[model samples]
Target: MRGRDEESGEFFSPSRSQNRRDALEVLALGEKLVALTEAQLAKLPIPDSLLPHIRDCRRITAHIAHKRQLAYLAKQMRREDDDVLDAIRDALDEDGEAARREVAAMHRVEAWRERLLADGDAALAQLLDEYPTADRQHLRALVRGAVDERNKNKPPRQFRELYRELRELIVGGSAGTDEEDADNVED
Candidate 1:
């Protein structure tokens, strides 16, 4: 319905359009929250009051129930501070990136393990050169045990150990200390 006409002014329901936009935005947030895993949700900075709404949405499996829960969540979300939503989105994005990096690191470690197993001494020498502090004798024993286990078609106990050691040596060892050393150098 037109409200009033003032000197060629057109009447429109701007509030209705704004309400629809707000509802859509809130529903989008509800969708994102619903897609998040429990662990991810824990990381988000959501307030205690909103947790039940979010959890209820997650628990509702029926399509209609889920839709109703989502509507409730959207209404609740509209009452929250904008920063809370921003924080939740940021945390989820950060967690996603962290998970991706972890997967990539695992794949890289696996590739290195395979290379070390296939190339034997050549790869060992490369590993030693790269990680001077690595225990050569221990590594050789693990590698030998891993090879024996493979040849015998036994459970990959030693193979798993070898991967663990390589991961500890290459990934865990390098992730720390070096950054601190760099910071020290600047002092």
Candidate 2:
């Protein structure tokens, strides 16, 4: 179907090389889909129709059979709408990446909370050095309450609250630094 336009002398479709490149990109996307576990695939926006093909691709362990299945998957993917393919790519790229980062940040916060509980004043001093804007008095109060709760075998309400406050301080501090680093890079 690729030919020159009668009136404008422009191509009616992509050139052969461009067509091949597009196919390869789709093939690569198919590979990504094949490599993903079922749980990861569930997070994607891929259509149900493509799922069986992907599963087949995953199930084939033999070299030639796997290769043939991969090609079939690419062919099926190419038949899908351009918008659907693009949506799948976008979803793959942004697959709870922000949420994952936040979770990692929360883990760091948890570590700091544990350190504060274990190391007491030394950890608080180190934390203050990192987050100069942190409310020292408020943090000390929360730490004391958390310690008292642990001693009395009471509910860890203050322990949870301390974690929340630590997250706000540490994650917010890191975010500001990240923006500053980006600004510096722009210069």
Candidate 3:
């Protein structure tokens, strides 16, 4: 029975059902952690104390053994403070946001590439306007080579090179802009 103050009627502890629910939640989180690759795990804010437990859980291949090890990992994870768990969750959430930003940047690069191919100098002027540090003459040469390759039905070596150049320029520029935006927000 949960202890309660006689006058105020406030419970001092959670009931058994709540305890089981909390345990299951931790178990589910442990399963997710175990499923992640080593590189992926490095990106999260997991604690050193739970690392061994997580690794052991990951090493088990047998169904029953893995389940048992997972339960053990969950028990260990339950010992962590709520703040630690929240930090890990936030890191995981940030990974999705970071991936979305990267995809958006790639799409932006591809769109610029198509515009450059289609509109030639007009699009080049717009690109240089945004990324003033870009090499104007080099980009013009690339666009010319790409257009030549397309019309001649030759290999797309220049086309691919243009894509590589645009990806490097635009991805780097977008990262800089994101940082500037954050700094502006702070001010």
Best by lDDT: 2
Q: For model 3, what is the alpha-carbon lDDT of residue 58?
A: 83
Query: TM-score of predicted model 1?
Result: 0.55
Query: Over the stretch 73-123, how does candidate 2's per-residue lDDT look in tens digits?
Result: 999999999999987887777555555666667667787888789889988
Over 4 Å off, model 3: 1-19, 42-51, 79-96, 152-160, 176-187
For candidate 1, write residues 65-169 as lDDT tens digits.
899989999989988888887766666674665456566566666776777778788878877876899999998888888888999999999899998998787
Clashing pairs in 3: none
* Lowest summed lDDT window (length 10), candidate 3: 178-187
Stretches of candidate 2 off by over 4 Å are 94-187
| Candidate 1 overall lDDT versus native | 0.78
Q: Give per-model TM-scores.
A: 0.55, 0.55, 0.65
Better of 1 and 2 by lDDT: 2
Q: How would the candidate models be sorted by lDDT, starting from the highest?
A: 2, 3, 1
Q: What C-alpha RMSD separates each model from the true structure? A: 7.7, 8.3, 5.3
**Which order, best to worst by TM-score?**
3, 1, 2
The 10 consecutive residues of candidate 2 with the worst lDDT sum are 178-187
